[model samples]
Target: MRAIVVTEHGGPEVLHPSEVPAPEPGAGQLAVEVAAAGVNYIDTYHRTGRYPTKPPFTPGVEVAGTVVAVGPGVTGFAAGDLVATADAVGGYAERALVNADRAIAVPAGADLRLAAAALLQGMTAHYLTHSTHPVLPGETVLVHAAAGGMGLLLTQLVKLRGGRVIGTVSTPEKERLAREAGADEVLGYDGFAEAVRDLTGGEGVAAVYDGVGRTTFDGSLAALRRRGVLALYGAASGPVDPVDPMRLAGAGGVYLTRPSLAHYTVTREELAERAGDVLRWVASGELKLHIGRTYPLADARTAHEDLEGRRTTGKLLLIP
Candidate 1:
């Protein structure tokens, strides 16, 4: 098997490709012949030691493929099952092992590449819109980086829930994309808070979903209404500074939360439900997935560089 291994924490150069023996599934695991792997920012964090994983490890968590071997004690799955998982490790390889319980069956008509691309980001958007704050009809919400993969999905979900979306983007092209994804108002990152205030008649939005940390954190806080929730889910611009609790109180008693996909789908049942909703929406065409780029597995380094450079939009995939 050919896999990209992170031998040390550093730059994209650290992602070195090598030939190795294929891994066999352990108990309660399935060996998947990887068809596609989602390239996410978290993967870059792992490669750079920002997330603190040990060296000499494969860096991927989401994949979709056919099951080639099922290990002992695994049930509800067999060889040749088309499955996808957001909890699998070593997904940057041609083959990866997935815990059977964590794997979700891809719907018959769903594209495997789309499945892999949407699993993590889709579920993240699901919990953000449905659980974190639960956007209600007539409410207005702010979404940062609203033309990116998660942003587009979040915008669509909020619209489905009847919330009016105000999104921020870095470029005019991204603003158009955000609008197409159902954002009622799209603004440039500069002066977005003031724009949000103006758009909402100075009352502010009901909530703010901010993934671009550091650069937009303060603006997100200012864009919210009294008691509005600010969900900080990523640090695309950079990691935010340590915040004081007083900041929340001063910001109109607004709520603040930092969420991750793992915490949102901790249980197998929860994982299935969230992932199923996302896949169902994709199948029904209610939610569109923009797979902006696809690279061969060996081009993982270039993928990381492009992602970190913010040179691409939508979901990026590595085809194995």
Candidate 2:
């Protein structure tokens, strides 16, 4: 099977195309003929050792494909079933293994590439808006990098919950994309906190969905209202520095939490609910996914470079 292997932990150059043995279904797993693999920030973290993954490992965790085989003890799925999952093992390959419990059925006629693009980031958006802080009707929130894949999803989902979104983007094009995604207002990164405050009449927002860490952490806190929540989910700009707990008190009792998909989808039921809602929305066109680019499996390195350099918006996928 063809795959991208992280020969060493360093930079995008380290993601090498290699011919590796195809993975098979183990107990409770499904062997999938990979249609597409999602290129995400976590893959870069694995490649750069920021997430502490060992070298010589395949770098994708999200995939959508046809089931080639089902392992022992797995039920309710079989060969030829189209499925998607955020827990695909070695997903950046021609074939990958997915635990049956973690797999979600792709609706009939749904696009496999979009399934791969939507599951991970889509479910992350689900847990953030539906569970983390639970955006209330009429509440206003801030989303950083609002034109990026996750940002666009968050913007739309917040609006679905009847919340107003103030999004921060780096460019005019991104601002337009954010507005299209339902952001009430879009501002450049420069002094966005002040802009957010002015938008809310100096009260700040109810929450801030911040995926870009380091550069935006302080401003995210600054943009929050009293007792507001700051959900720090990703570190696209770089990881945030350690903080003093006392700072939360000074920031009007604002709450700061670092969330991960694994923690939110700890049970199969939770995974199904989140994945189901996201896929259903995609299928019905109630939710939109902008696939920024698709690369041949061998161009994984370039995908990482473009993503890390913040040169692309929307979801990126690798076709096998």
Candidate 3:
């Protein structure tokens, strides 16, 4: 079997496609014939050594595929059952071993490719809007990287809760994408804090969902009103330096938290609950996903390059 192997972390060029022994399901896992693997920013962080993954490993963390074999003690899923998983690694391969407990059943009506593309990002969006901060009616949310994968979904989810969305985008085209995703206002990086404040008539927002760290953290915090929440979820611009408690107090007496999907969905029931909502929205046509790019398992390098370069928009997939 073939898979993308990152022997050393450095650049996208390090992702090499090579023949590898096929993975077999162990106890409580499923041997999946991976049809599609979701490409997320976390994979970029892992590949470039920013997130410090152990050497010589597969980079992807999410996948959708048919179960070709099941481990012992695993029931309710037989060979040929289509499923998706978000917690596993080694998804940038023709086949992967996924934990049965972490897998979510994909709707038979949903396309396998789209489900794979949407599962990880979609569910992350779900938890962020419905759990982490829980955007409320008439609340104003400033979502950074609003044209990106989780951002687009998050923007829509915020609007679904009747929150006003103020989104940040890097380019003109992305502005359109964010607006299409339901952002009430979309602005570029320059002076976006003022734009957000102006949009809200100087009252500031109720919350700021910032994934673009370092470069935008201060501005996002500044855009929020006193006592508002700042959910720092990712570090696309590089990790922010440790902030002093006094800064938070001075900033706006704000509630600040750094969250990740893994920590948010640690339990099986929580995973099912979040994944269920994502799948339901996907099935019901309430949430739309843009699968911006697809790369063959062997071309993982190209996928990573495009993603890190910000050449792709929305969700990217590695098709096995």
Candidate 4:
């Protein structure tokens, strides 16, 4: 099997592609022949040592593939089953080991590439709008990086729930994309909080879904209404500094939460519900996924460079 190994935490160059022994499924695990692996910000975090990961580890976590082997104690799966998982063990490889509980069935006729792309970001968007704060009808919310993969999904989900979306983008093209995704208002990063306030008639939005951390943290808090929530989900730019609790109080008694998909889908039931909803929506055409780019497995480093440079939009995938 071939995989990208992070021998050390550093730049994209550290993602060394090499041949390795094929992984075998452990108890309650499945060995999958990977079709596609999703490249995410969390992967970059792992490569950069921002997240606590040991060296000499594979760098991917989300994948869609066909099961080639099933381990002891696993049930409801077989060698030929098509499955997808957001908690894959060493997914950036030709083969991966996925816990049976975390692996979800890819509906018959669904594209494996699309399924891989939708798993992590799709579930993250679902939890942000449906659980973190629950975007209610008649409510207005702000979504940063509104042209990115998660942003587009979050915008559409909020609209589906009848909430108005105020999206922040970095370019005019991105603004158009955000608007097309059902964002009621689109503004550039500059002065976006003020624009949100103005659009909401000085009341601000009900919540702000912020994936672009550090630079947008303060603005996200400012764009919220009194008691509105700020769901900080990612640190694309960089991690934010330690915040004082009083800041939340001063910001109109606002609520703040930093959530990850792992926490949201900690149980098998929760994982199935969220992943099922996302896949069903995509299959039914109710949810649209923009797969911005696809790279060969060997080009994992290039994928990371493009993603970190913000040179691409939507979900990026590595074909194995």
What ranges in model 3 sit over 4 Å off? none
Local distance difference test, candidate 1: 0.92
lDDT digits (tens) for residues 1-320 of candidate 4? 89999999999999999999999999999999999999999999999999999988998999999999999999999999999999998999999999999999986767999999999999999999999999999999998889899999999999999999988888888888888888888888899889899999999999999988999999998888999999999999999999999999999999999999988998899999999999999988999999999999999999999999988888999998
Error of 2 at 146 (Å): 0.4
Q: Which residue ranges in model 4 land beyond 4 Å of their true spot?
A: none
Error of 2 at 128 (Å): 0.5
Q: State TM-scores per candidate.
A: 0.98, 0.98, 0.97, 0.99
Let me know the TM-score candidate 2 reaches against the reference structure: 0.98
Q: Which ten residues in a row have the lowest lDDT in candidate 1?
A: 106-115
Q: Assess candidate 4 and give its TM-score to the true structure.
A: 0.99
For model 3, residues 222-271, the per-residue Cα lDDT tens digits are: 89898988999888888999989998888789988988888878899999
Give the Cα-based TM-score of candidate 1 against the true structure. 0.98
What residue pairs are clashing in model 3?
A: none
Candidate 3: worst-modelled 10 consecutive residues by lDDT: 106-115
Candidate 2 structure quality by residue, lDDT tens digits, 1-320: 79888878898888889998888788999999999999999998888899988777998999999999999999999999999999988888999999999999996677899999999999999999999999999999999999999999999999999999999998899988999999999999889999999999999999999999999999999999999999999999999999999999999999999999999999999999999899889888989999999999999989999999999999999998
Evaluation by lDDT, superior candidate among 3 and 4: 4
Give lDDT per model, in order: 0.92, 0.93, 0.87, 0.93
> lDDT at 218 for candidate 4?
92
